[model samples]
Target: MSTADTTQSAVVAKLSGLDRFLPVWIAAAMVVGLLAGRWVPGLEGALNAVAIDGISLPIALGLLVMMYPVLAKVRYDRLDTVTGDRKLLLSSLVLNWLFGPALMFALAWLLLPDLPEYRTGLIIVGLARCIAMVVIWNDLACGDREAAAVLVALNSVFQVIMFGALGWFYLSVLPGWLGLPQTDLAVSGWQITANVLVFLGIPLVAGYLTRRLGERAKGRDWYEARFLPKIGPVALYGLLFTIVILFALQGEQITSRPLDVVRIALPLLAYFAIMWAVSYAVGKAAGLNYARTTTLAFTAAGNNFELAIAVAIATFGAASGQALAGVVGPLIEVPVLVALVYVSLALRRRFTASTTEAS
Candidate 1:
């Protein structure tokens, strides 16, 4: 095989172990989180007892840990490259902010209108946008790594700016404007801005400094191939830890209203599938290649549940039904994205042919 073929095989081999079995790890997390919440007396409470301003300290740390590695991998210098792919970039932003949120808003109302807290929670999940985990899904689908990195960075900034205002508009303002029943969300503008700074703000700065310093010290070759490999798994490990802590705190909610998780998941599952189809079709129609297409698709379909969960807990209490809805986003997100990864891979076959023919 050519050197390129060999390198591709090696990369796939490295990614496949964790990427292919992500659903399993998530399932394990669910089981252990539920069991710990049920069986271990005071464990959930103990972890949650250590909180400031209604945010669980452990999950906050976990989210920070999970986020930094993903952020650190971004080549911020290459972000300029996305500007050239204006159609690709524009498509991602439109789908994520406009179409994606509207679809989620409609779904939340249509699916669980009576459960106002949970519906608001679902809306929060949609509005936050995916900054971190979609990188994993994007990579698994052989997306443009550079584009994925750029979009991740872009979305991080976008969410910090847009999430607060858009969230207010959808959950509070627009509903009142439209004469629909408002969810009566109590999150203040200051609180919303602070949450963004506390969460995304820290990691974005840290990741930027880390990358710049690493490159200056060791150079790009060492930073990408050697440095990144060692730390890349931190995100996945922290993700599982957060999942356990989340379900642990939600033990009572899970046990009493297990079906509520399912009910909430219904819109989420539909959201993922529909969002993928929409982004995928849009990418193809825009004449983007397979890599860019899958990158946009994953970016559109995925949720920034870490931010969503944090906002929910900060806005609503940790044990609130809203927080429970935030937890369910990942639960519903993982398996569905895993399935979409397969679908995107299958679609890649067709996309590759079309691109080749056009070229």
Candidate 2:
């Protein structure tokens, strides 16, 4: 076999059982939740009744569980390496913070002019950015792992700081200025801030502390190789658990308004495709090699669906259209990004060919 084929097989082999079939698992969860919600009596009310300070306890737990391990996997101590690459750092910041949110705002507004809840949700999804799954996608595509870790850490910081302000601006202020119909998300700006603090803030701190303390006690090798693998699967468990609950709560709405789900999906599909292609092109034009270019593309394209879903459910409700929109994010993202991984791999070979010819 060719060297490229062998490398490809190895990379694909690294995808754990859960990661490889993520879409299928998520779909199964959705189906189970939907069936339970549709057929079983009083399930929604039971789920709703168990809330801690208005946020669903199950969902809050799921959000934390879904986020913490991923954050722990970030190589926080090595951030300076990525920071030194000004071209890559500046490009990533621009693509993630500036261009990504703006593009989603435009697409959400353009595509879902009449559906304010889904639009707001999409905007929230955009603002959340990718702090978790981009690492996996980057690795699958042979992107620079250290770059992905640093970028994910960078995104986590921005998400906590900017999510609420950006949420208020896009959901309330921007629409008013544009003379567009604004959504009464029924939550104040401060409430959004509080939710961001509780959900993203808590997990970020916990993850950082876990990494620092673990590495200090047991060394980096033990922390990453031994400790991280043990907790890695928990994130998937939490993700699936959250998805089931979300779909169950919103089952009636989802089943009733299937078209709205499709409507919600269109903007997301476009956002991922456009953001990735543009970010990849930007990375290449800026003279990044294939790995860093791929890293930039995945990091720029992915969203923090866990954060978005938590925020949507916390700010709105578990059964809100906004929450449903958040749920749809990973459904669309998993398959699309999995496809993009192969696309990145194909382009990697092309990149190599071009470099060889140039030399």
Q: What digit string (tens of lDDT, one per residue) describes model 1 on residues 168-286?
A: 78988878887888765555555545555655677778988999999999999999999988988887888788788877876666777888888898999889899999999999999
Root-mean-square deviation per candidate: 3.4, 3.8
Q: lDDT for model 1, on a 0 to 1 scale? A: 0.80
Clashing pairs in 1: none
Candidate 2 per-residue lDDT, tens place, 146-224, comes to: 7876776677677667776777788888889999877554434554445556556677789789989998899999998
Candidate 2 regions exceeding 4 Å error are 52-54, 114-121, 132-149, 164-227, 289-291, 305-327, 345-359
TM-score on alpha carbons, each prediction:
0.85, 0.78
> What lDDT does the true structure give each of the candidates?
0.80, 0.80
TM-score, cand. 1: 0.85
